[model samples]
Target: MKYTEILEVVRQYIEQFYDAKEDSTLTFHNFAHTHDVVTHATKMAKHYGLDERETFVVTTASWFHDTGYYTGEANGHEQRGAEMAGGFLKNLGVKEELIQEVQKCIMATVMPQKPENLLQQIMCDADLYHFGTEQFSERNMLMQEEVERKTGCKIDNNNWRKATICLLESHFFKTGYGRELLEYGKKKNLERLKRKETRGMMRKSHIPNSCLGE
Candidate 1:
């Protein structure tokens, strides 16, 4: 089956299986995020001259990256996504060997889990492209919301800022293209952090009595 056909099947599965009304995992793991990952993954794969087989496998993995969210498992979502991907691809007449490759790509995206192959590395970087993009602020907010909503973790301003800073500090790009092109965006994120710290200081400097005209 063609990639377009496989994507359509994945879309249908997300719509039919993902319960948007649910307040847990399915709430924020929407189709738009999947589409964004796939778009970036495709672009990166093409730019890097990935073979067609690798491209198809990586793109399929991208489409199913968040499938575990629908299953309500936070930690093993990559494995769940891989399982779902295998089934979806099999239905699309994808060969057994290619399906395994796609599954490997899916599993390679798990956080704290290192990618074992080049295709995996590419998809992993593509998954995190937004972190080094101009829209990183807004994208990070969505992720925080998803985590808070799903896990009931209340992230205060201080903790959120600290976590964002740490992520920016530790993030490493897998592809040279991503590193070269996305450096400016990462700098912007750093600047955003500095501005946040400055704003906090300014707020602290203000006197409540001044506002009351004491």
Candidate 2:
């Protein structure tokens, strides 16, 4: 099979797997999210003038990146996803070096992301493409729902707002196109988060003393 064909194979495989394993609770990591990330990665790769082989590597890595969620392990999904990618590419007769690049791309997407190279940086940015876009709020709500369903833990609105604000303030997009497309929107999102936090605090302070802790 051509290396080119592998992308389609991967795309079909993940869609089928997700269909078989669909969980409404996993709103954030479902097939739609996967497709969106891959699409964003593809666009960035094209913008950055990735050759065909580089495109294949980045896009294939994007395909398998989130699949470890199938194993129900949230903590090490990157390693699990890399292992899965390695096995799949091996069966496809992909080169050891190419497979390693793909694995590295997968691993580079882990939170507090540290992407060492251009391709890995694209993977990281694509994985977090939503963070700097108008869709951040809607996508975050999906993630919140998934977390609540899985962990049965409730993070109060104030805490969630504070955490999100911190994340948006600290995050940066690495590539030129990444920053071009996302940085301004991310700034706006941060301001919106701050405003929302302020409103929440004001509402809390306005609550009558009867509900306050003694």
Candidate 3:
């Protein structure tokens, strides 16, 4: 299939499905995030010299990935998203082989990502491109809010900062294209997060003597 045709199909799918089942609580996994992934995936596909068919698969998978968050299930959203993508694409007359590849691309985006090939690697890195950008902190805050709302358990600043630090230190873009494009920003973002975490710890330890019942 031509790129324009499949791209439009993927766009329409996102608009209709997301509108019908949009979860207001999923601040971080909403349409904007999906769009970002698709945009980044396209860039990486071009950089990696993906053929037309491979580009189609990557874009389709990116569009439908994380859709299962609308289902209100915290765990296994990747598998659920893959299943949703399979059914939708199959209904659109997409070949079984293409649909399965698309599903694999979607599944490969799960955290601690394990991409088995170039296509999967591109999509996985695109899915997490925000981790290395100036918008990382803004997106990070939205993620924190979503977690707090969904779990109904407040995560204090210190705990959240520590967890965020660990995640940034552990995360990396899988593809060479991704690393060359994002590694500097990723390291900068990590430094910013480390400083933030340290400041948070210091704040917690700095108790004022005025409140000591003197």
Instruction: List, residue by residue over 58-150, the lDDT tens digit for candidate 3.
Output: 999999898889875979999989999999888888899999999999999888899999999999999989888899989999999999888
TM-scores of the models, in the order given: 0.82, 0.95, 0.93
Which has the better lDDT: candidate 1, or candidate 2? 2
* Candidate 3: residue 149 Cα off by (Å): 1.3
lDDT tens readout by residue for model 2, 1-214:
4756788888888889889988777879888999998999999998889998999989999999999998766889889989999998898788999999999999998888899999999999999999889999999888888888888898787788888888888889978888998999999988998999889889988988888874
What are the clash counts of all predictions, listed in order?
A: 0, 0, 0
Write down the lDDT of every candidate, Cα atoms only.
Answer: 0.78, 0.89, 0.88
Worst 10 residues of 2 by lDDT: 1-10
Model 1 bad stretches (over 4 Å): 1-28, 201-214
lDDT of 1 by residue, 134-166 (tens): 788877788788878776778887678887888
Looking at model 2, residue 197 earns an lDDT score of 87
Best by TM-score: 2
